[model samples]
Target: MIRKFLLAALLASATTAQAHEVWIERDGTGPARIYLGEPGEPVPEGGDPEFAKLKAPKLINHNGAALVRKAGYLEVAVPAGDVRAWDDAVFEPWGEAGKKESVVYYARAGRSETRAAMPFEIAPVTAHGDRFVVLRDGKPVAGARVTVITPDKWSKGFIADASGVLRVPVREKGRYLLSATQKDEGAIAHPSGTLAALHRIATTSFVVE
Candidate 1:
């Protein structure tokens, strides 16, 4: 019974980490910040352990840019073009005994730039950021779950259609952040070890007028 209880606790921790979302947001005419937490919530001063595992994410368009560690998030320069960020440094095993697997996270900041830019991406379908398509490896990830966070801290959940397109209910005019995730069970080798699953997380942020 004690072993079972410990197993349950481990699984619960893994689920909490997986449920966290990563996104990048920029205020008007300011530098972009990469945040990890539930949308609209205040980030902790030291950040979560999972968040600390992330080294610096690569800015797709701005290759040589630097990431400055802030109090609770990482800041980066936003160039004229659309901003996108990708990271896979959080490589560690999670889950209990028989179901153990490792996960890697990928994030994006802007609209669809290219497949090479972000392996997993949420591309805007409409001119505004209300509609999006979830893509993995350049292919549509149908039935993907997407969480939308409005400027006022309001949040809603939506699922992608057969074509991977999803429409978000945008009510006000401010910054919107959308997060989507996809999982692949194929095995692959990494410096950390052999990864049994690939967890792809994509987020796109935009301002609506």
Candidate 2:
């Protein structure tokens, strides 16, 4: 009988400690309860650091109706060590009172996929410079063709290697635009006899001086 009574008391205490509540007040006007749950429980914060970063939807009061504004969204991924440095990035509107609105967002750091961008140096070489490799998702894109066009109508072309990288020679030092295109043959074909599918294209521009 004593053991049964002790177990009942322990269970009641545990239940009370597990109960928790979270809420947001409307401009500090009154106590408005938003959520209620137990502590140490996981919740979806709405930010993914793996593939891309997006702004969290904001809650607003427009003439007593809740309106959401999703403009002014910025997406960027920095190095792992510089994650905390983004805290100082101002997220609020700067000018014009009528254009300003409250902001709400969530951040995720220390993810494994975060890395630095590739660095390239441009200098005047001979009629053509050494070739460089390009990879997407760490794999070569074979059969991909790269083209470079200069301001004087000069152009050169190269094909990507098995590793998805292409090194082409650039003749003449001036503003140049580089573009690549690759088509997937296995894509679903449309009935109109014209290929209607997705193609991967990457383009970059640099000034050779």
Candidate 3:
């Protein structure tokens, strides 16, 4: 019968080339077995069976806490700290990928909480030497909103104490292009927005010289 209709059209094109990415393995002492779907690209060399098909979903934080998911993607669990706030509910999909779907969000903590969100440091102002100090995970990110562009001058705002850190008081140092921003308080969700569609928010940036 024409090879049974070409074997059902190659199994319907491998089930429509299945997609829905996001996978991470390491489940034992701290829970880390997140998977979504179409998980078929470098995840098949163990118990085989196509690595059991891939579906995983029963997220149980248990105190290794921090698993936000509104727009999707953000899985902390280990010392769990850094992750200030950005928007997108905090991340938690499992399927129905968006952000231009083709999903691929995976995480497996440990190693001091994955180095505790390090990214924001520009120290170099030994006593008002034009000024420059913007540490993040190492502390000192007050107000947080610095922008220093110089072709002639264009400095701009914030960072003065809340522990997010920022301190750029320059007056004449030249060669500047520093940038920093922080304005993600749940991003934009209004059912009375404060974070409720599952909640998630984390935004951090760097680049100072």
Model 1 segments more than 4 A misplaced: 1-9, 45-50, 96-99, 112-116
How far is each candidate from the true structure, as Cα RMSD in Å? 2.9, 24.7, 19.7
What lDDT score belongs to each candidate, Candidate 1 first? 0.72, 0.32, 0.34
For model 3, how big is the CA root-mean-square deviation?
19.7
Comparing 1 and 3 on TM-score, the stronger one: 1
State the lDDT at 57 in candidate 3: 30
Best of the candidates, TM-score: 1
The number of clashing residue pairs in model 3 is 22
lDDT of 3 by residue, 33-126 (tens): 3333322233343432322333333232343345543212234354332222122211222211121111112222222122323333334334
Order of models, best TM-score first? 1, 2, 3
Q: Against the correct fold, how does model 3 do in TM-score?
A: 0.19
